[model samples]
Target: MTDENGWDMSASAWVIAQGENGDFTRQFVLDPVIDAWLAGRSFASALDVGCGEGRFCRRLKARHGIVAVTGIDPTEPLLATARAKDPAGDYRLASAENLPFEDHRFDLTVSYLTLIDIPDIERAIAEMARVTAPGGTLLIANLNPFITASGGTAWVKDDSGAKRFVKVDRYLQEHSDWQAWRGIRILNHHRPLSRYMTLLLAAGLRLTRFDEPPAIGGPTEARAAYNRVPYAHVMEWTKA
Candidate 1:
């Protein structure tokens, strides 16, 4: 019924297909975020925003049995794939800016490498805190837009399976809002971790810790690879 609707469907399908073989996207930067998650003491319920194809959902489900993991995304095919892969997983096809749940419905909110791709990140962050009960944690693994390594954009590989890549500057353009295109294109807003901290704090959250994942992929053949991890930031905060 809207522009985002179709785009969401396409985005979801693209991710589902990407994960059909293996979780290509999540693998790119799972370590830094997972470490933060494992550090959490507990949670009664969890919500994952921009939950692309349930990569983080599966991990959450396995870590916390029947923890009432709810994944919300605007992509239909991605939700379907997530639903099919984890039959018991709960999902809602909705935009990140507007979630379809009552306030304080979740004990925790987890988003991985999702903030940068989202056009309305401020609204999304607000919605995340809204769904989280006070004192609950919000763990986000947003793009350090300034990371020198590389984004998870796909690349070609060598005959020997060595990984190589290109920056893929125009990757998120079609998916972003025209007004926000400048920021996304140039990664101007998503710069240093301090910026994210300011945004999170403005949303009425308290910053906890930050982590950057180490790059440990290849050095043998040199070919197209995926999600070159130059650097990333892992954030932990509480809804205050």
Candidate 2:
């Protein structure tokens, strides 16, 4: 989880500017994560891993009335931002491969667009399934690999941005069904669609639902860039 690349994960410039300039991208989260969770049913406690600034976690609390919520991430700076928003919910500095919690402690576990960044995705997912209480939901989300493979045009504009994008694509291209994701230097495990499904099944999770949120969760131009590939996708399953 140590991002040696020194990517500016320090409260994503997007998130920071939103906070400072009062233009957070939080609203976009509603269409996919919160709304999707509520559509299923209310759960007692939930945990969000890779919880950038805990923005979505806080929204889940406020929007769905989930009483117990926690957010964990390896990024200390981001965790600090999450803490500032909701001091009540537990916030931990941790990695997905080895969470700092007891087995089966949470009713639901989720990560937002984070799996692609994880170096050890299978282990991380195994941990996710391992920590979920039986019958509890485990949600995995990422940008569609097909989008990247099909030349979905969501590239970052500078060297800093290109590095982040390349690091992710390098690992993901291995499982790329979409064709365009096959370049070398891909450091991420951005599995293709089938891999996502296969891993969930292998982890003993019963498939429940999948979501491909509309146009980057909204049609706005700024967000549209990310959505250029196909906004968001969620794979839901219950531990069995």
Q: Which candidate is the best by TM-score?
A: 2
lDDT of 2 by residue, 2-71 (tens): 5452333334663554453133133464244547566758889898988867776876688678888888
How many steric overlaps does candidate 1 have? 6
TM-score of each: 0.70, 0.74
Candidate 2, position 229, lDDT: 42
Query: TM-score of predicted model 1?
Result: 0.70
lDDT of each: 0.64, 0.67
Q: Where is the poorest 10-residue window by lDDT in model 1? A: 177-186
lDDT of 1 at 18: 52
Question: Which residue pairs in candidate 2 collide?
Answer: 149-180, 170-185, 170-186, 170-187, 171-186, 171-187, 171-188
Task: Tell me the lDDT of model 1 at 29.
Answer: 49
Steric clashes per prediction: 6, 7
Each prediction's RMSD to truth? 6.5, 6.7
